[model samples]
Target: MTENPGFLLTVLAFVLVIGPLVFVHELGHYIAGRIFGVKAETFSIGFGGTIAGWHDKRGTHWKLGWLPLGGYVRFAGDMGAASQPTAEWLALPPEERAKTFQAKPLWQRSIIVAAGAIVNFLFAILILGSFAYLEGVPRTPPVIAMVAEGSAADRAGMKEGDRILSISGRSIGDFEDIYRIVRFSPIEPMQIAIDRGGNRLSVDVTPGVLVERDRFGNEYRMGQLGIGKPPAVYDDIGLLEAPLVGAERTWGIVRLMVDTLGQVVTGRRSVKELGGPLKIAQVSGEAAMMGWESLIGFIALVSINLGFINLLPVPMLDGGHLFFYAIEAIRRKPVPVEAQEWAYRGGFALLVSLMLLVTFNDLTSFGLWQKLGGLIG
Candidate 1:
């Protein structure tokens, strides 16, 4: 039987993308732990059986697992990848206990737990900043060059040469800002503040909903104002300023993610849009085919997502650990072990359910069920 070259490329691309990101994330935790005088017992770049491994001079057992889905850093006295405290760890003598993660001050522990996501965000910023430095930043003005007839902007009495000042009270700096605001806001009403002929005017416009498909045939629902802009102008970014640009871009992505999740929660967007590992693998492969630049950009985007997701207040995640730490701070003591265990179990279940949902969406997006039906027919 011949192997599919495309499938092979997809698998390789997925591994290449995920492995480094995972390593960066865990390295964040490991570094933070080391800084606080805590020892990492094991640093594995995947879960389950070890494919390759070694011990550092510090005695941290570093290993590469067969499964490349995710990775973890197990600190001394930590029970598992989730970093649950162990009975043996708790029972350790004062000297030994001081070297464990749980023995750290609340603030230090919080920083240590939150370090992975922070590093992910920083990694994305570095990549994005490099791109900005090399390629320059878009300096497009927010002037409307064209408005489709009888469309949302036209209906709202907007005209060509009108410079958009703000959308929903958020100031717009460039033409790209308009698209960013409109894209996730399908059919949503927004207040548009524009300066026409040097006179400021405010108009309420409901964006027209558009269903667009990508080259991969994946569908996206977007809001369009039926407005167009002139060609974008690129300005060379200085070395120092490029990082600021990258930070701004990263924050913009974070805000967009928040808006997306809000839309999903409010029933404005479908949950089916959520994707999982398979979707990532497909996209990674596609990006690889597009070139190194595209693949690198995709990695940065995913890195931001990873950082954002890990910060959510869910158990078995970094955020969940921070949540417990927050409670510990308030109560002046840790949460009861039994309560913590139950909460962890619930969090684990919630995560598993979400994983299944996203996986199902991925399969559906790939037409897996349709192909199966065809085979049966």
Candidate 2:
């Protein structure tokens, strides 16, 4: 069958977006390994059967593969890119063993493993900083624009043009700060400090609970104070100040992610919101079509999430490796190879399952499967 134009665009966009980001990620690991005197046997940009490969002066086999999904860097004496230990590697001579990743001191090995995520985070911060520097940083004051009629804000005596000074005993500097508080305090009655008609007054506003659905039908149960935004004002930040704002913005995104994850765990949020590669491809393609600025912002977001996700303690990931290293640090020795192998196996399986589930959701969201089913019927 002939490929669809839209499908081609998505595939191209996915590769363009994910390929360089992943390369940057693996490069972080590779650079760290080289710095610590570990010999990189292979520095691959993708997986599956290799399309073309060549050896560098240092004997690191650099290759591109058929799949543009992900990349890896295999160090000498390591079994593969994930840096799993091998029996043969363990049996190497002392000099050779010294060059293996497993042979490094705890701190060095830990740093090497954590470097990828750190780089991702830094990349995001830099991108965000650049965006803020180019476009003025938003400095929206906490002034009410419109309150939903008969909504929680209306019932609490909130009015148009009222400025929110604080919520739940915490002061608010930006409009987003107020939403941050109400979004998390789903069940609590908020003690709102408002500036109304040039007089400071306190009011109790209990946020209402509502279920919001995304385009993919992913549902979110959130606390809404029913306050809308006024016209935004931008603050022209200095070059030095932009990075600080970017860092703060990155932290805010991280906090929001953590809150969402917590809500998911507590059954207050639906797992449908959890997406995978296909969702990323769709979003990336859409963002790219919007504009370079939007695409860059989306890529920055993905980078942050990529870094955070890899830090998860599940096996077969950077975080998983660091977790084992933590155990080794405490025990004064590495975790047994056999135990690690099993853990990695389980982790890989779980990761695959999640990928499949999310891919299915993506297909469903795109209505591709339904169309295919129609043809079959």
lDDT of 1 by residue, 1-377 (tens): 31222888899999989999999999999999999999899999988899999999989899999999999998887665455577788788999899998788889889998999999999999999999999988879999999999899999999999999999998899888899889989888899999999899999999998998766565678999999899999899899998899998899899989988998899878899999999999999888887899999999999999999999989899999889889989999888878888889999999999999999999998899999999999
- What is the TM-score (0 to 1) of candidate 2? 0.85
lDDT of 2 by residue, 1-377 (tens): 32233777778778878988898889889989989999898989989999999998988899998998889888776675345667788789999888888777889888888999888888889999988888887779999999999889999989999999987666789887887768765665769999998999999988898787754344556789888998788878789987887887788778778877876788866677678898898777767766788788998899889888899999989999999989989999778877887899999999999898888877877788899999999
Q: On a 0 to 100 scale, what is the lDDT of residue 89 in model 2?
A: 85
Highest lDDT scorer: 1
lDDT of each: 0.90, 0.83
How many residue pairs in model 1 have overlapping backbones?
0
Tell me the spans in candidate 2 whose CA falls farther than 4 Å from its real position. Answer: 1-5, 80-87, 90-93, 160-171, 178-224, 372-377
